[model samples]
Target: MGGQTAPLVWGADAEGGAPYVFYHRESGELVGFEVDLARALERRLGRPIVFRQYDFKRLVDGLERGDLDLVMNGLEVTPDRARRVRFTRPYYVFRLQLVVRKGESRCGDLACCVKAAARIGTLENSAASRLLADLGAVALLYDSQVTPFEDLQLGRLDALLLDVPIVRAFLPHWPDLVAVEPPIPGRGFYAIAVRKEDEALAAQLDEALAFLAATGELRAILERWGLWDQGQEELLPPGFSGSLAVSQGSSPPAGASPRRLLTLALLAKAALVTVALSLASMGLAVLTGLGVAVARLYGPGWLQAGALVYVEFFRGVPVLLLLYLLYFGLPAAWAALTGTPGLYISPFWTAVVGLGLTYAAYEAEIYRAALQAIPPTQWEAAASLGLSPKQTFVHVVLPQALRLVLPPSTSDFVALFKDTSLAGTITVVELAKQYQIISTSGADFRVLVEAGLITACLYLFMSVPVGHLARRWERRLASAR
Candidate 1:
């Protein structure tokens, strides 16, 4: 599929699907047979191949929705699947095989083993499961291969069912697994698939595959990892020892940024989420911090003392600790108190409360200083004018106090903006969350640098006008005196 409207392909990380195509999140590189084969085919066809990966069963939905042009995972061209989407002509062929402890390879059926009460584990959607189901055999469906591998090694499962090449690639990493007699009994083929309507693309891919096979490139690529038993005329010597590593945030060779070229929309969504949270947090801080500071400053002694304890406890704690206490712990407590399943507040609102309360301690001190800084003469003058204490505070003390603290208040707003990053630990998709996403999903740690760069730029953008206003307020305070 080469047109602008052409569909993209979806691949799966079938465990031991290793070396055929393994995506290491830390490396961000797509590896193995299908990975390399897809790349080579792009070169052959002179068309770009865009690949998205997920678990195999999940891939079927993308295909049905036309989100995928083809499924490139080592999926069998099964009869049932044929009822759903057209499968290409078979390429590499194999049967479902059972890997058991050495010397116990051939068992008539799981019926004999179950009488002995042995456990067998196979992957969900694997051919081994299909064959076992056909024979009415009992087997465990393992979501990940390592679980079954560990169980079989620890003597929990009697056998592991896997296809031949996967078992082959899987063995060197694990020295103990051995294949026994396979149950499906016949060779099936592995091929890149497209919808039947995509027969044109299939023909184009078939020609490329045939050319690769003829040039001995296919067998050669396999032989490097000892997987080249396909009885071809010639084999290209294995060229490289390993798969490509994906490094997030690291600049690509030159003139290419992963965000721009890979998934710009995902990154932009993260940026917007970050900005929205930061602004909301700052707005709440102004409203709630004023109330918190007033409660601490001028309330009854007991009330002031309690507010003091609240402010001091939060201020003395690390910001990150406060973030968690508010986001997670407080929410749990709220749910318990309310007798509801999910009555906790949102992390954004809670963050504003916690951070606002913490910062309000400093604001309380600022208010106390501002109130005290007003000369007794000024209050006496107001009293001589027949003004009450409330009038004196409102007309004379409060305005000067706000002016005195304008600079620090501005700085505090900036601090709160940056602090919104801690919200990501609760799985909020903020700017910092994007860094973790790109670093883990894109498999590149450079996402940190990328996010940092964007954050610093954003801070400059927001801080400049606010900083200008704070300075202007300072100048006004000087002129007033």
Candidate 2:
């Protein structure tokens, strides 16, 4: 940081940063090359450097926002980035390589649709990611340190694009991970970047770098971290990036082949269908539940008794067990009604019906409570004014009951948000379905976390207005009293 204001410095001492910038398997301390290098730079400048340990991608974004004064992580300077940002002297040499899951392989034009069209996720803010962009592949920047590698370890990503040393470092720990060698892209060195205006400071940093290069201090540090070996050569693992026929995935200008694209399209479309069917089933279930509640409250004793039996049975059963009955067992009943052999219904639709019906039982009780809670005198007064019994209930009782139900309705919707996830058991697609897709296809847990967070936020958004209305009605009622 310049003498003006010491902006926070963000770095990730992760990946194969062992003995230098390694990740603690337990407590997660930031160690390794980037870690020590930042401290060394601080000592030379005679200023305290505020180090923020994070993932590689966050460091890059923070740097772009000027939120970070510097990033000393395993960053590589690339041609695309060169035109956008300024760079410090080469910190170390690292090559990019491909990592694939064990027992899984793909075949294609390597440059056209299927090969080029694969969804490759890699660590954020690394040289390998930069190479991915340069190659014009559809590269998804996965979470830093933890997830990028975890996904690779878990079989989520097609393959990970990582540094030569990093790939080597993780290999001993994960026996299933395989690296693609021989055909490494044009080799490049790692560097720290700053905005163009930081040229003055960049010059100062370059001078400091030059001095470090001359004193063998940098090399000593690198050697200590195990980054530098004999003859200044990087420790090469079994794989190399240079020799492989680096199959570039299809770019925007390089559209993927039709079949692979169609597979992905179908994946997304199926998710939509599941959610749509679930919502439709929920709509029907809500109406049926509402009618049953109203009938139980107002209909003749026999009808009320029947409604009670329906509500109690559904409410007593576990949602999952109930769903199984509807999905697997209801075909016979459906066929009996239709005079067919075994009636066929989609699993997604069945899930919607089961979940909605189960929830509706609870909702019906809430609605019943709303109607019953209205003062009996209000109904009597409406009748005294010559209003019909139906008019008395509708015009006088329903409005107050609706207002009374607002808070519980909010709570119900929150419950609904969570219940929707359960639909995944019966094959209904929603947020949970999206999570499964990300898990099976990319195999990343961050997507699940992200989707869960998004769903939580959606519930929060949904609840806010209801909460507001509850408060507003409470105030209105208090004022009238």
Candidate 3:
């Protein structure tokens, strides 16, 4: 991950990005306003620009880890971010636009949306979320900018708050959606981010940016993408002070007060969602595992081979990949192949199916091992007693096998609970996503520390009860034997 001595690496996430830094649809080559700006900056510094792609939420950590020398991913200039990294002059100034489904006249502006108590969607850790939170709206935080629009199209959300450039880029493609009037004023500006320790590099980037603005080169790049607007002209005038282009955010200082209690309550609710998802997924996994184990043990030869392959395939692939496949890849494939509108699976069922099928692979092995561990004599004895094969298995073998698999099954369930955190990627508001939204909106890092502590405690709390029950059942079964 170290790139300090190499070409100047800039981190960006291409997903959900359009005119910012994304691949051209027809050419399939990366080209965007930010991409061009990065190249120009690279030339100014006498270094090649190496673009390292990452998830939008991960850009900050990537920069902090030295995985990138700079981040030019439309990273917003905020007081909270300023504490952790040095930001170059504002390269782009943007406002938040409220997008709604066309012909929906319930809310015409941001104020009306808030007054109606609508379910608003926005990027999870952005200034938009902070605004929604202040407005006391039910903010549906998302990892990608696209999902909010998709949800809006389907009537799942009342409005979407996103950057003006993003709305302009995606709106033309979605005829059913339109931007509501009175766009939210600029909350901040986009800037290149440098690690706080790399002050010299930050200064150099700031100088290059100032020069670019003065020469109109930056404006040209933005204009080519149809993103040049009065917002940039007013916020980042030519030859402006790059070092002090923006100051502290308008939001009040973050601290521990009643807000801490509110955050905890929200985390608790999110924890419940995590638990419910884990329980449902575990239920499906157990049933699937039983079917898989039985197929491998007693079914026809081909069925046994098929079951084995299923187990191996799922266990080998990562759960996150499985989720993406089910949530995004499958739907797109279905739409393309059938020439139909894209299929949209509810986030809840998507999480259940993805986690369930993936864990079933491991559970199948656990069940098979337990069944094999039981002596063959029990089956023979039951057969000799004139019991039918099905009854013999149900009455004699199944009970013992259940007890044998209990402990490990409990362990797997515990693991499944924590893995539910990955559901955040598909737009599920589980504990981890809630933590992210809360942690980012505030400036104090200690609040995040407190949030982390509570998360660990919650995991421990859930696992301990299951472990105790498993031990109790095991001892009872042992004594009965």
Candidate 4:
């Protein structure tokens, strides 16, 4: 347990996890119902509260890893999750809400939305998603709660399914959106979760929650956020609305075979996404790199300087930062400037352009080094043989440079394959993100282990052949020398 001297650290995705935990842009401070609750709990426990930001899907992982003492970011108590984390008594009860553009007729309720086969969007690992899956709805799963609503506003989605409180938080911002007359059927309870082994901390949290409920503090907190409702009114204890019993661990499904076929299939699909993106981006990088190398080596002085700046700027910045700028920032700026609705780059193309351009900078440097390594006398010799500069580059310089750059290029390809995982931040569902979704959705550690192994094997499969080819080329080049 965290003592008075130590901070009570909780995990949250403040950037995307709004209403639950978020940074107030105007005040430059973290403010939300959960933030307030954490502060109140801190006072009760005689410790400072620390909100550690993480991806919503990774919050539990942070708690399990001991990077966090608890998680309070609207985490629902699910059987799968109960297997991994012992949850405190529920502090809030919420339902799934169906949201659509105001006055939309065809798909308002859950039954109608399912009947119409409308394109719905929801958070990937939420109970809402599993319900949508069971209903056989065509759902676009998003990592960020913000994204699906954004898409809904832009008409990219026919409906948005999310927690009731989340919908309420968002309705004030998007006037065109409206929740259905009633929320969806099932209720989800939010609780602070701790690792199952941490019984002492779990007990502390439960006790604190009990005190908050008894004192009317919890009800005040919920009302302050506009999260108090009739369901909550019926659910709290005497002074409050309601609370659920503490959760025990949920064991794996009884009939689950160790075959892991479905898990492998899911991993294979994601691996294909990784491979396709990598290959396409590599192709673009090679073309751009050749152009950059040519410009730096043979173009005018200003062109050479500009080429150098482009290469250095991209190489200096991290790929993830670059991706964020292009995927979120660039499109937002475009939409703002043009006043265009739904005019944004897809995550797929964003990854392709962002990764291609970033890697091109590195590729350019590789090509430049390889180009420079070739004797200047070779160009002179080609000129003496009546070859033009273009002819010399095509027939002489490029051929030799390609061989020289092969080994490093092969390594870059492998690195890029791994880096595609970064696209998950921008909502590209590559192998690593798929693994996260599947493992957490099932609350099965076995899926995580098997998925990780599959990803590793696939990466190795892709790179080993390239490595062998590079070595063979090295031997050939050495023999020629």
Expressed as tens digits, the lDDT of each residue in 1-481 for candidate 2 is: 3464454355442322343344232222344556666666665565666764333434554455444567676667778777767888877777666666666556122233125566566766566566568778768785433356677666566666666656554444456766665426456777777777788767766766655555555665665545564423332333322321211111111121111111233334544554465456557666877788898999999999999988998899988787657755576576568876464455566677777778778778888999989889998889899999989877788777777766776576556655666665544445544433333222235434654465555445544665687778877865764
- Residues 368-450, candidate 3: write the lDDT tens digits: 99989889999899989999989988988988998989989999999999899898776677887666644432223364578
- Which candidate order results from sorting by lDDT in descending order? 3, 4, 1, 2
List, residue by residue over 331-426, the lDDT tens digit for candidate 4: 557768887634356677889988999999999999999999999999999999999999999999888888889989988988888899998776
Instruction: Give the Cα-based TM-score of candidate 4 against the true structure.
Output: 0.55
Of candidates 3 and 1, the better by lDDT: 3
lDDT, candidates in the order shown: 0.61, 0.59, 0.77, 0.76
10 residues in a row with least lDDT, candidate 2: 253-262
Highest TM-score: give the candidate number. Answer: 4
TM-score of 3: 0.53
**What value of lDDT does candidate 1 attain over all alpha carbons?**
0.61
Each prediction's TM-score versus the true structure: 0.48, 0.44, 0.53, 0.55
The true-versus-predicted C-alpha distance at residue 410 of model 1, in Å, is 26
The C-alpha stretches of model 1 lying farther than 4 A from their native spots are 1-8, 14-17, 24-28, 102-117, 181-184, 230-481
In candidate 2 the C-alpha lDDT for residue 106 amounts to 62
